[model samples]
Target: MPGRLKLYHNPQSRAVTAHWMLEEAGADYDLVPVEFREDGTRDPKILAVNPMGKVPTLVLEDGTVVTEVPAILAWVADAYPEKNLAPAPGSPERGSYYRWLFFVGSCFEPALIERMMRQDAEPLPKMMVGWSSYDDVIDTVEGALKGREFLVGDHCTAADVYMGAGLWWGGMFKGPRILESEIIQGYIARLAERPAFQRAMGG
Candidate 1:
């Protein structure tokens, strides 16, 4: 049966990741675009769903409200295994898969945001910030993606969906400096070649 997926989205945001995930899973979903005014105010109804009023919230057919980007993608991937978007826990690949998934939210994201801010907050203790330094985090990313076409390996898993999307966005920004690696360049170019990515970009 087709899963009922309600994607609260706007093309201009990270909802594009959710959009690509939906397309990859071949899920039956309704893409609902929520609009805000030029002054940056949102509908009271949307604020009810997400107090932060962020885009890309996924509401399951059963009415479970999922928040955050990585959480939503991981949930959607696990919910539909036949789609093969994730690696099973018992599989050796699962560990590495989870690493990238969590890294996207835990490390890469915060680091990217900090770089974009061009300001630093009080440093998190080494143990507190999962990603210690921007270069360290990026070097880890380079290591993970260096020799492989995908994060874990040859197959594109949910990890890549998030990682690749994050790469695409970071590539747009001046920080992270990913293009220098031939591997990263090839991998990101591969992601861009995906029909889903193309369609998302109006290809």
Candidate 2:
């Protein structure tokens, strides 16, 4: 039997990604909605559960708390391997799966933030930059996604869970067709069609 799963969520936050992941993993869980207070503060009650006061925090039956979007998705998938949302550790595809997941959090996110803040004009050492540049990161991801349905292969894995969410958010800042590349747009479209994603999106 699986453990009880509790998901703290605020639809407008990163919790949306975990909601899709929970549906994809087919995990038995409950979504506790959090609302911002009228006084311009987050719900103090949730702050007790997550000191960082962030949404999308996962609480396991064993009372363990998991934060961070990628970590939460990775844990939920690993906890329910029967879903096969990820390549098991030690497999060749696992390397690519992990690579894509981390790259979104480490590389793509920073670049998007930098671009949105309009700070890219400042001279900075490319080597010192983590995500390098938005253009470079987009090119790298587009090249990798060209012939593959998913980041790892033809199968939908946990990496797609994160990457797809990233693309959706990127579209908000970069416009509706940020990933209009033939392959990437199609790939994201396919992922969007999944019953799980649609279901999580309140289909």
Q: Relative to the true structure, how large is the alpha-carbon lDDT of every model? A: 0.80, 0.84
In order of listing, the candidates' clash counts read: 0, 0
> In terms of TM-score, which candidate is strongest?
2
Candidate 1 structure lDDT: 0.80
Pairs with steric clashes in candidate 2: none
Off by over 4 Å in 1: 38-40, 119-128
Worst 10 residues of 1 by lDDT: 118-127
lDDT of 2 by residue, 1-203 (tens): 45679899888878989999999988889998888676878887678789988888999888789999999989988988888988979999899999999999998888888777865477345689988877888888888888778888678888998998888778766632375666667877888999998888653
For model 2, state the Cα shift of residue 112 in Å. 0.6
Candidate 2 residues lying further than 4 Å off, grouped into runs, are 37-40, 119-124, 175-179
TM-scores of all models? Answer: 0.89, 0.92
Write one digit per residue (lDDT tens) for candidate 1, span 1-203: 53688888888788889888877777788987888678888866568778888888898888778878888888878877897888887788888898898899889888877767754565555576767877777888888876688888578888898988887788777565765666667888988888877766552
